[model samples]
Target: MTTVRAGGRLRPPDTRGAHRDAPLPAPPVSRRRGLSSSRVAGWGFLAPVVAYLCAFYLYPLYRNVDLSVRHYTVRSFVQGGAEFTGWDNFRQVLQDPSFGTALRNTMVFTLVSIVFQYAFGLALAVFFHRGFRLAPTLRALFLIPWLLPLIVSASTWSWMLNSESGVVNYALHLVGVGRVDWLTSPSWALTSVIIANIWIGIPFNLVILHSGLQNIPAELYEAAALDGANGRQQFWRITFPLLRPVSAITLLLGLIYTLKVFDLIWITTKGGPGDSSTTLATWSYRLGFGSLLPEFGRGAAVGNLLILIALAFGLVYVRVQRRQTT
Candidate 1:
């Protein structure tokens, strides 16, 4: 027998169990060194990725910030010199009359696109979630728009929405409606781009919302059914409440993406019909590269503004998400 003492209490241990009761010896020095070496090797494996991010993302971000406050130009880009200008770049960006229009168009385009995309996408998600025959095939086919390159989609829509000879106008003519200028008309150009973006965006919504809907247990529906709840009631009482998190994240992401949309608008309208379709993205490009003077500084300022807006939205999204999870 042996004495064991801990926490101000004492007990007896059997001599036969001495080996099992003994504290294990520390590992050999080489084994301890091996653990530290393995840790170093693990970090070594991540070195390349860290280096890549620093070289690309972090460096570009730093350059963007630097450019935003300086008088950068085509000449400066070629000669590697730019003069420091305090808030003049931001002042010009804010003072530009067209900037106001671009801001409004960006707002309208982002809001309308998200609303329609969410509406149609959620509807399709629910419709397909019921699992009818050929549903998978049809869902796959619906993703064709999303699978197509943005350039391809934008060009196709441009052709389809052409003012005079387009399929959309032709269809409208058959209904006794006169020709509608889609891309060329200032009043309708923003609307046309928004419509195209909405169509392109719906597939994303459907896929995400569909996955969320699938995660909800079928047993809940069955129990609700036994309770004599109708279809509409079950949807609002069961499905809608369960889908809030998915919907919030999807809408926020869509808003951020839509706010930065340039390719679709550029390819279709070129933000044209005299700035009618100009968004912050296209406007920023026009400032930096498309202008005669090439106000790279102003463009950087706008880009930074866009980044700040995205960050604000992201913060709100994070807060909402955390509240939901908690």
Candidate 2:
């Protein structure tokens, strides 16, 4: 030994032994600064949709609200000026005699259409869910009406329902039932429109319900069967409960579509035969464009009412959805 530390004696260093110090580790990169490429791509993809809604949906909604408070015309619009009228337009729309009739007719059409469309659609969906021969082909054929242009379908249905020289009358004649004036008679005009609407709506309902039925897991049905539950019991307990969400969505959509129907009634009857078939949409159009002095303000009010009704329905739908999800 040659040296000693503060409190101990030191031995001589051995040549064969070695002492090593580990190198300091590099500093870690900040995780906060490291952006995920996938997350950035998702935001990039969603930007276009966000921009579109702001431009189209929000802008139009703002314009509609602005128009609802003003007295505007084709000339006023061209002149770039309009006078403000607060709630007078709403008052006029409410005071109109035909407005009540339109409201009643729209309500009837919406209710009846919802009932029949859902009933037939649910039935057809259940039938096809069994996977019969040619089921796919039949389902495709059924969707054809939905794929067709609304104007074309309306025109075709109108021609077929004509009192004279139409297929319906010809068939009736063959069966000795005589001719029926489907569009010309006030009594039948609204009913005829409702029937056509129902026909057009059925395909959509069927497709939705069919998809809903298909999504029900087969194991649930098997379990029910194993427990000695019959077909009716299984449907009430399993199928209906599972389908509530889809049914709610379909019903709300159908109600909105039916309430706003104008083209079919216009093409067929033009709300004619003493305005018996005029729904809210047709009446609003008549008030705005069909009159000598167009009532833009009043039409706007009616449109606002329609918007409110739709919004109410949407709120109800959202609430129901939230409850279900929770």
Candidate 3:
């Protein structure tokens, strides 16, 4: 019970087990009200990117999937007679005689090109990292191949590798070696294209890896030296670990670029010498565009397969990047 007075009041007795005075709790913060201008600006900036991806990437992907399933032709478009074909195109492409050969060639080309490109690029990067007097000039010179237009580079390489009067043959003659048919021969044509690809790819790898090497702290090398580690030991122990992320990025990009290589191959061999050098991309081109039959459906199927492979590689790259960041 409580007794009340005129100016001062006596409070009622507490029914609780214990009684104590506690400070009032703070009011809850409204998240939206509390957001900083920076956060608002960040979301505002992201809105356009979100809209663009939805409109461009997702819409096109959906359309490509739809197109792959449907039987839409040039005549069908004019006649309004498009229909859906259930996996028939994929079956036809799988059954094609050149499919196996094209797959093999593409795989071989990708593997060989990646190996040589990375190896040569790493070697060049290591050499440049040693601080040569003319390294900057040499680095700029190496980038010339990358800067050249694809058609120009392919044409130049083709002329140089020509068996009869090319510079390659002339050099061989000077070295007391017999002339070899570089582009005309089935065995040599693919190799020649691969060499050209390696040249184009080397600069890209070098740029990436050299930047990575430059980012490594000099103190690490100095410490390793103090611990009696040689150059090879220091590279494997310190340099390799730090360069892993860059190496992964370079490899993924190189593989993707090498997989889709077409212009060089087309200009060099045109998948010629009896389809010996026909890659998946070139094969798809030949089937849908180059052939009399013009199997558009089959070509679409091959393109879809390539897309899947690229997606898988992309997923792998994402996972690796995530792991590295963490």
Candidate 4:
């Protein structure tokens, strides 16, 4: 405190501290350095993910887009003198007769697979949610289709649906029904592939929907039951509404998976019997690498179409989700 003498009385002591007693401002350089280090550390942590996306996702997408717009023969694809064709490849694909069949087949395959997979999955989830002695065992058994390798499952289905000696035909013979060409005729071919896909996808839905069911409060169901709701009523009122978010995600994922399904179709039917069972996925592979002379541009265009379809569905889901949240 500063003391100054007055004529008659002592001046009041100064309460404020001197400049030397004041705290120093923090060094901005150090603060800036700290922020820089933190930012670097954050980016360091994110670098791997970014790199992975670039290498595995972004680069391939770029290449696919490039391929779709260029006239790339096998040699040109490798040696890099492909002429740009803009949308010519897309036009060619649209003009082809197979495009209509492939488009229709793709839609049918995706929608049918998603519908049956979700329905069967929800049913199984509900059934198991009731609990039983063999619930775990039964659920595990049901996952056999999902857990098996695609090749193995597709091959097994191929054998079971074989026109001549398939067990399906044998079982049908036990009844009054005769052998049906599951994979040969155009009418049955897409259905056969869809059936196989549904089997493969059901367990996934079951697992996800069951988990979602677990999240729904038991009290809700109990309250509904006490209100005289039967099983079906309780499911509709309590379960289905609560399960909508899960169902949306499951359906979206299934749509994406079923859209790009190539291995199973290729392994089972090879898009055979004259493009009868051909979906966009199989058709893309056929155009790109199915034979000696690959139509790289057209094939890439088909793949781009598939990507667009998936993207559209994804955008729709996001919009719906946003609306629900709001």
Q: By descending lDDT, how would the candidates be arranged?
A: 1, 4, 3, 2
Error of 3 at 197 (Å): 0.5
Q: Residue-pair clashes per candidate, as listed? A: 0, 0, 0, 0
Q: In model 2, which residue pairs have backbone atoms overlapping below 3 Å? A: none
Clashing pairs in 4: none
- Give lDDT for model 1: 0.93
Quantify how close model 2 is to the true structure by its C-alpha RMSD in Å: 7.3
Report the lDDT tens digits of candidate 1 across residue range 214-242.
Answer: 99999999999999999899899999999
| Candidate 3 C-alpha lDDT tens digits along 221-303 | 99999999999999899988999889999999889888989999999899988888899989878866787666666777887
- TM for candidate 3 is 0.84
The C-alpha stretches of model 2 lying farther than 4 A from their native spots are 1-44, 223-230
What TM-score fits each model?
Answer: 0.89, 0.84, 0.84, 0.89
Give lDDT per model, in order: 0.93, 0.86, 0.87, 0.92
Question: What's the C-alpha lDDT at position 306 in model 2?
Answer: 78
What does candidate 2's lDDT look like per residue over 174-237, in tens digits? 8999789999998999899889888899999999999999899999999999999998999899
Best by lDDT: 1
| Lowest summed lDDT window (length 10), candidate 2 | 14-23
For each of the candidates, the C-alpha root-mean-square deviation to the true structure, in angstroms, is 4.7, 7.3, 5.0, 4.2
In model 4, the worst 10-residue window by lDDT is: 12-21
